[model samples]
Structure formats: structure tokens, C-alpha cells
Target chain A: MKTLLDLLMLSCKKASELIDKQLLLNLSLKERLMLKIHTRLCEACFEYEKQSKLLDKLLLKHISTSEESQIPIQINIELKQKIIHNINPKK
Target chain B: MLNEMDTNNPATTITSWVKLYSDNLFSWALHKTSDREIAEDLVQDTFLVAVNSFDKFEGKSNPKSWLFAILNNKINDHYRSNFRHQTTNNTISLDEYFDANEHWRPEETPQPWLVESSHILDNPEFTKQFEECMQRLPQHWFSAIHLKYIEERKGVAICQEIGITPTNFWQILHRAKLQLRKCLETHWFKI
Candidate 1:
């Protein structure tokens, strides 16, 4: 039998899409309500929301420190010499 | 080539710029690409392009930013070319995680991670695993997330840079996060 919860329910796929979209954009009233109902009834979506948030925090910190402010790598002297030679053959 | 090493042209000389900027550029390229040979080639290519267009530099923008702009283009080109050649099997399907009724499969349900696992973000081992997992993602997905969260760019800026529409950006972010979460669970949380 069709019920209100069943009518409002979103599939895991749709619920997850809304979850991702929520990070970038605001959900409408219906989307928010449907997703909320889906998550409450669906354990997987609940855990996905938690893990997604955790990933954002951890990845932001991890990539900022590691990729943005990296420990300086030693440049290959030979490579530098080769580049200079190629750029200005006379020099 | 004519000698351009006069004091008046100090900043523009190939030798002077190499001594000053090569180390910084090389290190940056090496870090972003994670391959020594490719990084070296990119740096070389950047300099060659810069030398070709030295006349257009105009001394308006800072040399570092101009050089970085060139390097960024080179990186984008490499990724675009690589993406075209890569196989399509890496794409994730929503159907794999959900049933026809739109519910998650039992195997697809996520287990609760340790509450304190967020602290592992600072750990070196976890960072390595995170980086590996990120690298495993399709190039475009990695680029989108990298520009959005890692670079902290605005949504519009990310879409502009990636040449994706706003809606497409959100979809990519959603799928990328899903893949990242699953990868992290296997490699880091394990709970």
C-alpha cells in the first residue's frame, strides 16, 4: 500500500545526490524534506552523510598542508642545467 | 642566440631566471604531478614557452604568477590528454550501490567510523593513503575537488576552470566524495 512516507521517500541514489548538492547549493523544501525522511529510514544514507562530512574536513586539512604548503623538494641540478641550455643555446 | 645578459635585462635573462626560479617551479611541479621525470619535463616546457613569449610579459604581472599560469596550463593539457586515453571502467554507477526500489544494498551500507578518526587527518600515514586515493580518482574528478576544496576556490571559479556547468560540478563532487569515502574507509578507518 502507498503511504505518505513511501511517497516522500527518495532512493539512495537520489538521496546521495541531494547530499552532495547540499554541500554546494541549497535544497528546496521538498528536496530537504524528502532527503531528511530518506536518511531517517535509511541507515546507509545516514552513515554516508557522516562520512562525507568527515572526508571534507580531513581532505581540506590534508590537501592544504600537503599539496599547498609542501616541504620543498630538492631540484635536480642536472635538469636545471639542461633547461637553461635548451632555452638559450648560445649561453 | 645573442647575449642578453646585460645589467639592463637582468630579470629577463635565461641564466638569471633559471638560477632564481627553477628550484621553486621544479618543486611545485614535482609535488603536484608526483613524477620526477614528468615534473622535469614540465619545468623545461614552461621555460621554453616563457622564453618564446618573453616579449609579451610586459613586466605587469609578477614573474612567479605568470610562470605558474603557464605551468597550470601545462598540467591541464597533460590531464586532458591522459583522460581521453584512459579506460572508461573507472566510472561509478549509482545502480551499483542501490536496489531498484532506491534503497541501499546491505553490502553498500556504510559502517560507523570511529568518532575520533577525524584526528587521523594529521597523521602522515593517513595523509599518504588519502593522497593515493585521490590520485586513483579520474583526473577530472580530482581536479574539480582539488580546485574546490583544496584550493578553496568558489563554485563558479571551479566550474569555469574545469569547463563544467554548475550542475555538473555538483554531480562530480558528489560522485568523487562517494569514491573518496569508500577508499578512505578501506585504507584509513577500516571500521
Candidate 2:
């Protein structure tokens, strides 16, 4: 018979796992049952799990949409020239 | 991730490698320090370090990883150099907050502050407040929180990168969270 405090800690740990959706999806039946029980009794853990899920979604969205521009042609040429000059000073 | 093309020409090989890795190295340093100018300097320093040690690279790993390994060392060196000059708050013991025996026990199950995604992005005030709260944190706690939450690095990776044991990593993370929670509740939470 786990105390409410013990149950709460377990729920907190599971809430953190919500950040990784793959882990969330892979939760064992027993773990799912435990989460269900904990969320029903613990509003804080429930809210934490929800917020963690939202945060993960937002972060992934930000990362995926970010574009990396290619280096400018002039800058690349200059860099190449500089390297060539360094390697062969007489040129 | 290596851009190794015809290493027979040392000059061309070095130039290609620098061009290929410059963005990645800068990004890595920027993430670590959250400063663009500092990141650029660090990346430049990394290239110099890499050139001097090119003979030691031995093709054991991808060039990107190798560059990153050097960049990480550079970042650590920067931290070490500035650590002596930095002031840290000594009022509270972050260690006590993370004791496994006294784990996080929020007074009441905190209700999630319901803010839509668009609202979060649009509200400059919210962002400012959050940044302020983050600035108040101790350096180690701030680094741990940023690495864990913002960068989304794993505990094991953080442990390896920071050269701390897993237990210490957890403790640091726990302390950071506890401090952040407290800060948000006290300053940012209007309701």
C-alpha cells in the first residue's frame, strides 16, 4: 500500500516523461494504469503532465520550422581565397 | 557529417572543413552561452584549436562530432576562466531542495496556467518575465535548466558533457526546477 506521497512522486516522474512523446506512447499497461490512478487523485501531477506535453509540442514545432540559410557566395569565395593564400603565400 | 573531400590537398581540405563546420560550431556555442558574439569567438577559437591538432583527429568519429568535442572543451574552458570572477548567491542551499528524501512536494497540485501557443509567442511581457526569472537563477542551475529544457539534451548526455555523475545531474536538475517553480510562482504568476 503506497502512501499518497509515494504515489505523488511516481506521478511526478511520469509527468516528466510526457516531454518525450515516444516514451509516453510506449508506457506499459501497468504504468498507464498508475498514471490514470495518479492523475485522478493528483491535480498537480495532472497539470504538470499536460503542460509538459504542450511544451514538447511547442519546442518540436519551433525546431522543425527553423530554416538555415546557406553561406553567401562572396563570403565563401573570400574564405576559399584566404585559405589558398595561407597555404601558398607566394600566390 | 564530415566534408572530407580530397585531404591530399591540405589547404582545400581545411577550408572545406571550416566552411562546413562553422555554422554547426557557432550554433553549438550559441546554445551553450546564449550569446552570438561570444559564440562566434568560440567557433573561431575552435577552428584554430582543430587546425593545430589536425594530426590527432585520426578519423575515429564523424568530423562534426569531432568538431563538437573540441567546441565543448572550449566552452568548458570559458566557463572555468570566468567562474572565478562571477558572483553566486549563497543564501540558499540548492542541494537541500534536491535531496531524494525531501523530493519536490508542491503545496497544492498546481493548476496549469492555461495559455494558448499563439498567446505565449505574442506576449512579450510573458517572455520578459520568464527571462527575468531565469536570470535570477544560479549559474549552474541556469545551465542545467537550459540544457535540459531548452536544448532538450538527455540526462546521460548532459552528465557526459558536463562531466558529472548521473546522480549529480538529477540533483542539479531538481534544484533548477524547484528554483524556477518558486520564482515563477512568486514573481510571474499574477493569479
Candidate 3:
């Protein structure tokens, strides 16, 4: 017989892993149902789900704009010539 | 200025590739490697390889992807070589997160984070902390996550580019996300 915790609990680690994995691929129906059940009963898992969703959103925005926040490193003419030279020593 | 015909002319366009593609490539390389010199070298090497292999030019894909493919190879080779030197701490024992019977530990339990954490991206301090946390990750793990979340590459493509199987990719991503969440909690969220 399955214990109460087995039916009710989603370990924090497994919940977090499933959260990250969903970003890469879809979770199975059983996995999704288990997560839904666990999050309803487990406050911690619920919070983790919220935070991870927010994290994915923030990460997407941060990465897209990260370059804009800084002055980009310039490749000067000298370096251009040096690169060309390295690529074509004959020239 | 680059017509389809001109792109095929290695003599004319290849040298000028530096002017056209170097800055963008350099920025991408810098973002991936996080070291200026290595980034610069990778960009140079990419162009060098392109020039040397100009005979085999097949312009089926756009120039950007072709160049990025070369740069990705350079990045892959780099982290693989560095892999042997660095001792990566990827062995995150699940025992710490759960009890023997697999319940969350009392002290280690997750708490409700702010609902408006998406707004945290607006805070410069939090962004700095996020970047610092990212830097602390193992190189391969960082590269994989960066490609997934930042570059927005698909999972299969990222796995192929990074030379890992899909299973390994997921495992790396799991450990990386776990560490990242912990880092953010301490530095930004502060439960």
C-alpha cells in the first residue's frame, strides 16, 4: 500500500527538476497530474512553481537585453587587418 | 552590398567579412566565453577557418548561422579541453533536499517567492547577482543553460551543439537550475 506521503508529497528536488525539464520538453500526463496534485497539497512546491516560471520569464528578458546594457567591445581596424592577415598569410 | 553572387567570391568578400561580421561575432563570443581575449581569438579563428575552407563554400544557410556554427565548434572544443583541468561540482546530492523517505527537509524547504519576480529583471543589482551566479556554474552547464534560456535555442539543437546526449543535457540543466535558484534566493530574493 502506498503511504500518505507517497501519494501527497512531491519532493522539492523532484519538483524543481520537473520544472526545469518542462522548459526543454513536455512532461507526460502522469507527471503533469502528479505535479498538479503535489502543488495543491504542498505550499513549497507551489511557491517553487511560481518562482521558476518567473525565473524563465526574467531570464529570457535579461538575456535579450543584456547586450544593450553595456558598451559593446569594438573590433578596431587594426584587429580586422590582423584577423585578415591570420586567415590569409599570403595576402 | 552583399549580393548572392558577391558572397561566393572569396577574394572580394571574405576579407571584408571582418568588417561585416566581426563585431556581432565578437559580442556573441564574449557572451558565451566571458573572457575578452578568448572571445577575440575565437572570432579570429572562425574567420580563419572560413577563409581556409572558402573552396567548400556552400551558402545554403545564412552567413550568420554558418559563422556561429564555426564559433560553436571553437567554444565546444574549448570547454571540453578545460573540462579536464577544472573540478566541476555537479554532484548535488538529493539527500540534502529530502529526508531518507524523500520528504523535504525542514530547513531546506522551499518557501513562496515573490509573485512579481519577473520585475526583478528591472533591478540592476539583481541582474548583477544573477550574472555572478551564472559565472559560478560549471562551464559546460553554464554554456548549456545560456544557450537554452538566453540564446533561446531548442533542446535538441543545444544538445547537438554542446555534444551531449539529451538525457545528459536535462541532468545538467536540472543541476544548474537548482544551483541558480539557490543563488538567487540568497542574493536577490532573500526568502
Candidate 4:
């Protein structure tokens, strides 16, 4: 059983890599199969994947909030002044 | 969103646009470069280009989108000149997390975050620490995170734009995420 499992299984490290790739892109059929086998067989890799997904969620919220006004980004008056200065028609 | 673009006196309303759009532009630029001064400069340059080509604007398109388009171009150019030339080191440090048999080391395994509320973003301290963790990542990694997460761009396109191959991009994100998870666990989760 160990030998058969080894034949199809990905190590947790490789499985984790595949998990992250799955978050961003579609894995090839073989990779998808292997990741499925490994995660089903190895419980730790499955938990890692869950945590990774959670991290992605948190990161999106973190950045989107920053994108919005959650982070105090002061609009500098000088930035407006400098831009107006540049566009001014120099006689 | 209406630009109020009068071809008659194209330059007149730029001052208003400058005030209206600088914050959004600077915010985006800051996200891209993670530098306040550079974000400021990019905002300044974006307004200059917008003013120069004001007649072309036509006021038909959403002014915010139009200005954002210009700012995005400036950001692309910024990355092209600054980062595209630098070689991306594809060496991913996996041994730190894996043992000889490629199993996760006991200490390096992923533990539960124990997050109770989905509204964790409401916690300013957690979000602040989250930004600190992100700031800890290298510039290229930050750019990768931004493009992948915030922009939701494809992996191949992100790799192409960042001058890294697809596999290299994969490895960078993997390692960068590993660091982030560890940092967050240490700092926020305490698990």
C-alpha cells in the first residue's frame, strides 16, 4: 500500500505548491489528480490548503480596504499644486 | 464620472480633476510600488500626461476610469524600467519547511488560525499587522501579491509583466505566501 501510495502521491511540500497554484491558475489534469490524492491521503496538506485559502481571503480584504479609505492616505495639497504647476502654460 | 471636457478651454478644469483624482491615483500607485514618494511622483506625472492630452479625453468616458487607465500605464512603465531589468532569482527555499522525505517539518506545519469572525478586517490592529507582514515581503514578491490578489490578473500575464517565467512566478508566490503565513501566525494568530 505504501509503495502504491508513493507511486501516485505528491509530498506535502509539492502538494502545498499545487494548492497555491490552484488558487491562482488551473492545474494540469495530472497535477490536479496528484494533488487530490495527496491531500486526501495526507490530512496536514488539506489543513494547509484551508489556511492558504483563508490567507487569500484576508489578503484581499486587507488590500481592498487599503484601496478604499480605510487606511488614512492624506491627499497632499502640494501634489495638487505641483500638478497644476506642471500643466500651467509657460509663457 | 463625467469629465466635463470642453475642447474650448481644455486646460481649465484640470485643477479640479487633480483634486478629485490624486487620492485614488496615489493610493493605487502606493499599492503598486509600496513607496509613498514614488506614488506621489506617479500621481504628479499622471496629471501632467492627462493635462497634456486633455483634448483627447472627450468627457465621454468615466473620468475616474480614464485617469486610472493613465495611472496604470505609468505604473506599468515604472515596473518596466525599474523591475523588468532586474533578474528574478528563482531559487525557492523549500528545505526550510520540508524534511528529508519532503514531509512538512513538525514546527513548520500549518496550524489553525482560530479566526472567529469573518469580519477580521474590522480590527484595525490586525489589518495594520497584516500590512506590516506584507511590507516584509521583497518588492518583487509584493508586486506579485498585488497583481495576483488585488488586480486578479492571470498568472502567466503576471509572470510576463514581471519578467519571470510561469514556474518562477509560482515559486515566488509559494515562498512569499509561506513567509506571510508564518508571520501572521506569529503575530496575529499566535498559533
Top candidate on TM-score is 4
Per-residue error for A78 in candidate 4, Å, reads: 3.1
RMSD of each: 4.4, 8.6, 5.1, 3.5
Q: How much DockQ does model 4 earn?
A: 0.51
Q: On residues A9-81, what C-alpha lDDT tens digit does candidate 4 reach at each position?
A: 8989889999888755789998989988988878788878887888888877665434444446666778777
Find the number of clashing residue pairs for candidate 4: 0
lDDT of each: 0.74, 0.54, 0.70, 0.76
Off by over 4 Å in 4: A28-30, A41-43, A61-73, A89-91, B1-11, B31-33, B62-65, B76-83, B160-163
Clashing pairs in 2: A44-B109
Deviation in Å, model 2, residue B123 alpha carbon? 3.9
Give the Cα error of residue B108 in candidate 1, in Å: 3.1
**3 or 4, greater by lDDT:** 4
Candidate order by DockQ, decreasing, is: 1, 4, 3, 2
The digit string of per-residue lDDT tens for model 2 on A1-91 reads 9886565445354443332323213556666666667667667667656654554444333322222232111233443344435544466
List TM-score per model, in order. 0.76, 0.47, 0.68, 0.81
Model 3: per-residue lDDT, tens digit, A1-91?
Answer: 9986687556666776777778777889878877887888778778777777776777677654465226355655666778877756687
lDDT of 3 at B114: 57
Candidate maximizing DockQ: 1
DockQ scores of the candidates? 0.57, 0.14, 0.44, 0.51
Worst 10 residues of 4 chain A by lDDT: A62-71
Residue B163 local lDDT, model 3: 59
Kindly indicate the candidate among 2 and 3 with the higher DockQ. 3
TM-score of 1: 0.76
Tens-place lDDT per residue, model 3, B1-191, is 33733645574666666777778788777766677788888888888788777666666667667787888788766765554344255455667567886676786666666546456766767777877888887776776665666556678776676556666667777777667777888776674
Interface RMSD of 4: 2.9
